[model samples]
Target: MTETVVANPFEQAQAGRPTGPLVQGFEVIIGFETHAQLSTESKIFSRASTAFGAEPNTQACAVDLALPGTLPVMNKGAVERAIKLGLALGSHIAPRSVFARKNYFYPDLPKGYQISQFEIPVVQGGTVSFFVGDELKSVRLVRAHLEEDAGKSLHENFIGQSGIDLNRAGTPLLEIVTEPDMRSTAEAVAYAKELHKIVTWIGICDGNMQEGSFRCDANVSVRRPGEPLGTRREIKNLNSFRFMQQAIDYEIRWQIGEIEDGRKIQQATVLFDPDTGETRAMRTKEDAADYRYFPDPDLPPLAIAQEWIDRVKAGMPELPRAMAERYVRDHGLSEYDAAQLTQSVALARYFDEAVSKGATPKLASNWITGEIARRLNAQEIGIEAAPVKASQLGQLIARISDGTIPNSAARVVFDALWSGEGSEVDAIIAAKDLKPMNDTGALEKIIDGVLATNQKNIDEYRAGKDKAFNALVGQVMKASQGKANPAQVNALLKAKLG
Candidate 1:
């Protein structure tokens, strides 16, 4: 039997309506399940080393191998770390939560059931707010739980198949789940990057995408507002920001096309083909029943006191958003400028360092955001390794702002300082004779010379050619060998020419 689709334009128009705000292209409803590998020396439940790049099984212990007579024990550092992350995210630590044995059989699971959290988690109820082009869109956190990671599989050449690397087998991971609050591919990427920053800023996760320190699985579906949700597709293990965008974009288009063609979307686990930029089904999606989650009897409940939470909370540094807001409110910097400066933790800390060294906040922000960032990118160096010291850079800005050196010539000082060849900003400026000629008599001499050389431009200036004055100003800059203050040149040139 053929089902007749409704032909109402009003309904159809909204049927293809995008997710979220329209300004972001289409509404994309995204809920991210991010797994960040915790920075711990050992696995969550074993004494196995969690360090990367050891001989494949060198880090495995008897507990890791599931040998007889060995009972699982929780790592204290992993628990403390979960609490630290929860507090940083403003989450509630469940007073008591039990670990569950997530039963699954694979080449990687030594005991055929991985120990993880199921019904009760380490943390519940938190929010992660992210910005999308000046519009703040918040994604609420459902829960964050601590779990042990499975061993990694390496498909190497053994004439047929690859070997396993259990070095990462017992590494701890924090799984952070979010409500389906995102509406576009752009928004999803933005949220992921912000979360990456927060995790790295809190010093819990390293945010190393290549090493799988940070990973996100995005659940995407299409739905008509006020209508039931379409069958959602789960795209898993999307590691990079670009891949996340690619996976979601392809998934959304595929779903929309499938619905339009009257085909039902099947829920399943899928992997992204980075080379082809498409999503492919890996397995029929596993439900909780498939995992057969049950409380683990091997380990007792982990405990945390309020004092520990307070101590962890007090130890967190200023976060990115808060630091950006403070820069704007206290330093008179624009919100856009402040965000750019605070986008990286290193840059933000460097900016604060310069401020403490007596640099004007506005000017310091401009130099760091505009000039310093551009230079660093060009040189392929990070802010922490910048050749221009904060003190030296601060002195350069102060000299320019305080009329010690001509503003136009400061660019030269900056380049020289950045090259690591210059002594000090002041010494370089003086040796190069780049001082601002604030003396009226000295400026008058250059102004007189420009008027004489640009006779035709002077005539044009008087003939209602307002822009001709700009040419005369150029002549003054040239006569002064580009060392003159442009603002002073403009004013002095206009007065003398008139």
Candidate 2:
């Protein structure tokens, strides 16, 4: 009996895409095929070490090299990693999945064919929901299949002749294919980022695009609103998110312009030139029939047990989406801020630790998303490498909450902590003299001095000029050397002025 494939409504939308207000004139349909290299110690079907950056062919054993008389052996660890990913993504792990020979001729492929899942994949039918701005968006998953990666074809060296590095050959990869649920470049990127976070958070992939651990291929096309889907060109191997967005945006514009000029869009695979900020067609895209897939006789059908799935699920950490929802329900964070904080496992963990250390949830979210993120981006680093500890940040925020220090003084204290000026938050505040002035008598004296000195402002204020009132406030803050509590200053100023 043949299984009937029911198409989802969103998938139908991809067929005859209706342009929303976001893309008013044209329907921009985008899909992603991400290849996330599994975090395994050895290459699939081989005992060869999968360590990256090895000397050419140093890590490839006889099995990886496909020596004559060698038989393939499945790696249990690779399958376990795949199971973990499936559980994290809410995908169905196939009880029995077959591996097939994907026949292709390329210099980088030692076997002249890739052993991959075709008819039935290991994982099937899932949804990856993420926030595209504040609006929640979801991309449907077609399947995630296990596959062996091809090696690199090097052109930089060898003096005009190409060389092959088999080090990456036979590396285990889980190729995750998504439906064309994305309507714009931003949605596509958000989906990619959310997927990346999931894979890395679950310890399945390292999520390193530079080393080709996690790479995205975007299928982009444009058509008139409510028209049939346009011919899509796949942008291959977008390693960076910035490059991914640039490539998709450029491809969409190019396709639209071509259509407007009466040129038919062709289905092809393209490469994004980071330096040029453009995409150029590489080769005509191949259909599934072109690969001529056949079952690999050496390996048996992969069988997964319910016990294994349960074990993997039990071992997994809390997923990002669930944690974000918890933040919304329990901590009273907005969906946008919750999503921002959960961008990475480390960031989310940092936020939770700060809150556990007595930092207000909303305030902690603001500092992490705003100031800490700014510094981390400027330094070109991850939150895990931040100099300030979560507890320290919590203490600083607590100071702000209790009128111990104003927001301005908190910033100064944070910079001091980041610069190693002091070990403790309170010590930093003391050393920098950043404590807010809470003494009523001292504040009264300061305000009196400000009012006495700014007689011109006083006259102007009596004349009903709002600027004069602001000027007096500024003078009071200046007189107190930015240590006065802004709320206290405002209250005292209104009382004295009246």
Candidate 3:
């Protein structure tokens, strides 16, 4: 809990990593501040456009720029989004919360301050658990608050100066801060990805890393096991998971190197460069005093009734973890398969619908996670855009299960369905004469014809040569044009050969 910075003025851009510290097994402690943009069509307090890919400044209303006499109007969708996120994280929704102005001045912030929740955040006291390998690590949440996003700064000078793009200003954000519970970079990454999943799954946030829909900042410090906490630095606006991990690692070593070199660490804000994998100092870290947070006079405190909380809870669909567990327990699916099926909400729904329509649980889960997912990814589309409908897929699976088509042929039918130019499975089978030769009488005729044409292979098989048996099966396969089911052919061949 040592928050004071010691006397040091080293540039944070040096890419200083101490090999000795890692070799000595000194650990890095990590914490994260994850910001998720609410998926509302309008700005938090304005009716300006929030759509992406719009022309710059096209969406900036005067309210977004904080012009004189322009009051703010809260977007109900944004508030509901924050509540959904809080409930997903198991946080207690505050019965009442106030909107506060976080005072700061920058070109991107048109108002010279941001309307953010400070000491009294809207939700608090939640825990998020993530898996590091097989072990589950839990991180505690300090608070999740509703806030208006600042405008974007477009770095265009090729110099250090960047221009402002106000199109993004006034977009709503939910800032979820975690306690200092992570002991390494892996834990931080695991926590961040899990949070991203929950927000995106609940349809609260878009979770677009590249577009800055979700951003993460990590605080890193190190100390001996029994020693007091060391000074920490914030690596800001880390947009991707890889950068989040690399930033924590680089920052920890940079601090340790300075401390061991008889230089004290400074508390500051730093930036992570994705290309170079290093952090550069931005400014001294700000405490609450620096922000001068106060309740905004324009907006009243948000009051939540018990009924709203219950309504939100009732509207929630089964979350990913619960659905995964249920799949394993109810359908007798393997843990691996269950996890795969429930990775996405749409995919999980597709799987269950297919199974309910009479596809065997194991087979249905396999197809949805495997072939269906493959087709979806190949076409660069989502399950919602899947060309093959669930009922169609279920019918195809049922056909394969009842021995009307072999597994290999079924894959062809799946591709045909995906390609959209091939006939229906039954029609294709009949037109291509692909009915499997399961009747020993039928397969026996084919096998005998092949053996008569190739007496050389028959002699080799009777001479106990396995390669000859394979050649004979191939000749039978080729004569039947892959119509003879290989399994039935093998059984018929064995009986006749003996």
Scored by TM-score, the top model is: 2
- Candidate 2 accuracy as lDDT: 0.87
Top-lDDT structure, candidate number: 2
List CA RMSD, all candidates.
6.6, 2.6, 6.9
Clashing pairs in 3: none
True-structure lDDT of candidate 3: 0.80
User: Candidate 3, residues 1-498: lDDT per residue as tens digits?
Assistant: 111121111222212222112313465666778889999999999999889988788899999988999999989888888788778888878878888899998899988889988766788768887677656678878788899998887887648777778999999899888877777777788889888878989999999999999999888877655445667898999998888888888887788788778898889899998888899999999877898988899999887778888898899988887887898899899766776676677778888888776688899988887778787777879898987777777877888788888776777777777778564667766765656766767778889998788888889999999999999888888887676888888888888888
Report, for all candidates in order, the number of backbone clashes: 10, 0, 0
Worst 10 residues of 3 by lDDT: 1-10
Question: Candidate 1 on 279-360: residue-level lDDT in tens?
Answer: 9999888777889888899878766778888887788788787888898899998777777777778888788888777689
- Per-prediction TM-score, please? 0.89, 0.93, 0.76
lDDT of 2 by residue, 366-421 (tens): 99999999999999999999999999998888888988889888888998889888
The pairs that clash in candidate 1 are: 18-27, 19-27, 19-28, 20-27, 27-183, 28-183, 28-184, 29-183, 30-182, 156-162
Task: Give Cα-based local distance difference scores for all models.
Answer: 0.80, 0.87, 0.80
Global CA lDDT computed for model 1: 0.80
Off by over 4 Å in 1: 1-26, 449-471
Shift in Å, residue 139, candidate 2: 0.8
